[model samples]
Every structure is written in structure tokens, then in C-alpha cells.
Target: MPATTSLQSLHVMVWTALMASLIAVGSFLSIPLGPVPFSMQPLFIMLAGFLLGWPHGMIAVLLFVAAGSIGLPVFAGGKSGLAVLFGPTGGYLIGFVLAAGAIGLLTQARKTARTPSQTPSWALGLLAGLLGLALLYACGLLNLVRVLDIGWNKALTIGFLPFILQDLVKLVMAVATWRIMHGRGLLPR
Candidate 1:
């Protein structure tokens, strides 16, 4: 390859590494709010999507999952491997990629559609993030239902109800972080 191509490849690799490391570090910063811990993963997930945009953000999240699957201590409590990926929380783990992509696409649209005052309010951004979070839970709850042989209502009650408050906090945190990063010019517009 040409030197320019090599450099571009290096840049891509570096961003990939940064995204994976951020997710892993975010996983460690948790509060153990319930059966599901309150973690900074959502914040980083949104950050990944917004800063890196859809394609790179998705790639980054996928790389993080792959690392965890290969048995790196990239998850909460330093756990990893295929079993953890297949565990109850596994679907949520896998859902992060989609969540990031969705958020990026939606956020980009919101930004393009309105002026600052007309743009989505902070609440709206938080709500959007929550929707992304819900996507993660939807996958998780469905997987739980399938694996645990439970009905949707019961599975949602058991697998999702408890996490609502924590996820709300996460959504708020992610939105706040997005604003902060935008202000600092750390995140792209």
C-alpha cells in the first residue's frame, strides 16, 4: 500500500482501539444499581456513536464484543469469554452495537433538522438515548424469555422492570456527556 493508505489504516485502527478501550473502561465504572449495574457504558456508547459516527461507532462496538468474546476481561466484574457473551446480559452486550448505530443516525438527523433552539431539547436527547437503551433491553428481554422459557410479560417484569431507573440515569448521563463533549469540541457536531 501507499504511505497515505497505510496512514489511513493506522488512523482507523487507532480509533477502533480507542473506542474499545473506552467501552471497557466505561464498563468498569459502574454502581451496581440492581441485578444490572448502573454503568458508564451507555455514555460511552452514545459518545462512540456521536463522535465516531455510525459506521465507525458500530465497528468499534463490534470490536469490543469480539474482544470480550475472546475472553478478555472487558466486561463488568472483569468477566469475559463465550459463556459470558451467552449469559443473560449477553444480549444487552451485543445490543450495544446496534444502539450506537441507531443513536448516531437519529442524532445526526436531529442536528440537521433544526437550529440550536429548535433542535432537540436535552430531554429529547435523553429520551432518544433511552430509546436506544430500550433497544438493548428489548434484545435482552427477548433472549431471556427464550432461554428462560418465560412469557413476555414475565420476562419483561423480571428482566427489565428492575433496570428502568438505572437506565434512566444512564440516559441522562449520556445526554449530559454529549453536551459536555460538544461544548469542549471533543465530539463532532
Candidate 2:
């Protein structure tokens, strides 16, 4: 691969910052249902992957986490600081990074990731989005069990079950939005 020109590098940096800001903003729209909150963060997390791919997507998520860790009002319900990172739902925050990376990696594998204006392939995107949710729920459930010192069954009952329908809706929205943006040549590249 050719080295990135200074201008290209600047674009990447700007896009990363923009996407990170979006992820933080996504958290502001939240509903505290139980151990974890329901937020549009998932949509933007997956969108970070769909838009930036791999390292950029992952870094955008990391930037958001770092902001929240340092007293920024960027977490769910505008909560911030290490208390939130180590809190019961912290695993979900970590999962955001993993899911973004996972989704980006999967999207990149399609070869069209860098060329969003190409023909849309929702199949790969759908698969990646589903796996992203799986990973997020797994991390969330494990953390809930460990932090709360509860059983897996109980953790599932409270932590994972309630968000299924809502998350699925978000996933679908992410895919549809990706398609619309891709068709419009609006995805970051």
C-alpha cells in the first residue's frame, strides 16, 4: 500500500474525531432499563465500523471511552469517570470497541469497504452486525455475572434479555443507514 499523503492523514484524523464525537453523542440518548442502558450508541458503534473500518473504527471507539474516563460527560445518562468504566455496564462499553473492530474487520473483508459507492452488499453487513451484537451481549453478560456476583442464568435474565428487540432494531437501522449513506457517497473513506 502507498504511504498516506499528509492530506490523507489529516482527513483520517478529522473523520476519526467526528465519528468519536458521534459515538459520545449517541450515549446521551439513553434509557436506563436495568443493569445496562439502552442507547443509540450501538447504532453509531456499528456505523463507526461501517464508515471507517478496522483501526479507524476501533480508534473512534477508544477516543470516546477515553473521553468518558477522563470526566467528560460522554457515557450513558451523561455519567463519566472511572466509576463508569469499572461499573457493571462497563463491559458493554468495552464491547463497543470490540464490536466496532469486529464489524470493521468483517466489512473490510468484503473489499468494498473502502469503496462505499460500489454496489451494496447487505449480507456481509448483516452478518457482521449480528456478530457484533453477540459479542456485546457476551461481554455484558459475563461482566454482569462477575461484578454483581450473580449466576449466569440470572445475569441473562436481567442483562441480556431486555435489550434483544431494541438492539435488533438498532442493527437494522445501522444497515439501512449504511446503505443510504453508501448510495450517496457519504461514508468516510
Candidate 3:
């Protein structure tokens, strides 16, 4: 029985590692902007939330960030290190953890709705994803303004405007993917 338990623990660790690697790969596919790059991180973040649920999703994101901080070439533009955490993009990077947790909370809350009919719809899932992204941007923009010594207006112009459309598209795709996969009962939990 002890040997069986040890094997199960190893399996879980392997699963977590695989998910972390997925996030690392997702980070590579990015579109460079002025201060922030539009990246596939959010897609995987939402996927982590949907598939692994609350704590695990957040842990997966944390592991990804930790990997990058420790000199792994896992960030956009092939950047890494503690210095990256102090850079303009740091807040946004940190915010990914919160966003995943928030998304997870929203989904889990919906799961406990008193009536089955009262449960959140696919639209709500999309909203949750968008909200998560917005939280990241909120933190990111604030960091950009302070670190770069720019005013709010300039930050909005340079840091915010460029990514809105691309983010919207991503939000839609994340929503659709969640809806389809969940409806088909194919999502990993």
C-alpha cells in the first residue's frame, strides 16, 4: 500500500510538471507590444483554471513564474530572471496567479448554485476569463506608469490600447473552448 501511494504521488507530480511545461510553451507564443507583449499565457492560464480547478491552477502559474525567475527561458522574448520580475511587466506577470484563482472561484461558485438552472452559463465563463485578463492589465498598467515614469494617459495609449483587440479575440476563444469542452464532459479535472 505504501508503494502504491508513493507511485500515485509521483504521478501527480508528473501531471503537474506536464501542465507547467504547457504553460512554459504557451509563454513562447507572443506578440510584442511597446511595454507588454500579447501572449498565449492567458489562454493557458484559463485552461489551467478550467482543467485543474482553483488551487492547482494557481500553483501551475506560480510554478511557471518561478521557473522563469530561476533563469529558465520561459518568458516572452526569451527573457528571464529576478530582474524581469522588477521590470515593467512584473505586475502583470504576478497578476496571472490572482486571475487564475479568481476565475476558479467564479467557476466553483457557479457550480454550487442552489438550482441547476441558476448556474452560470457559457457567457459567464467568458466574462470570468475577460475579468481575469483585465485584472492582469490593471496591475500591469499601474506598474508601467510607475516604473517608466509615464502618466496614466500615456500608459493607456501605449500599454493598453495596443492589446485590447487581441485580448478580446483571446477571450472569445477561451470562452468557446471552455464551453465546448465542458459541455462535452471532456475537460480534465
Best by TM-score: 2
**Model 3 clashing-pair count:** 0
lDDT of 3 at 159: 75
* lDDT (Cα atoms) of all candidates against the true structure: 0.74, 0.87, 0.77
lDDT by residue (1-189, candidate 2, tens digit) is: 345676677887898999999999989999988778888899999988888888899999999999999999999999999988888988898899999999989887786444645856788788999999888888888888889999989988888788888888999888888878878877677
Candidate 2: where is the Cα deviation over 4 Å? 1-4, 112-117
The CA lDDT at 54 in model 2 is: 83
Candidate 3 — which residues are off by over 4 angstroms?
1-15, 114-120
Q: What is the Cα-based lDDT of residue 79 in candidate 3?
A: 88
lDDT of 2 at 19: 91
Candidate 3 local lDDT, 60-83, one digit each (tens): 888999999999989887889988
| Stretch of 10 with least lDDT, candidate 1 | 112-121
Instruction: Go through the candidates in order and give the C-alpha RMSD of each one to the true structure.
Output: 3.9, 2.3, 3.3
Model 2 error, position 130 (Å): 0.7
Q: Quick one: ranking by lDDT, best first?
A: 2, 3, 1
Better of 1 and 3 by TM-score: 3
True-vs-predicted CA distance for residue 111, candidate 3, Å: 1.9
Measured by TM-score, how close is model 2 to the native structure?
A: 0.92
Residue 147, candidate 2: Cα error in Å is: 0.2
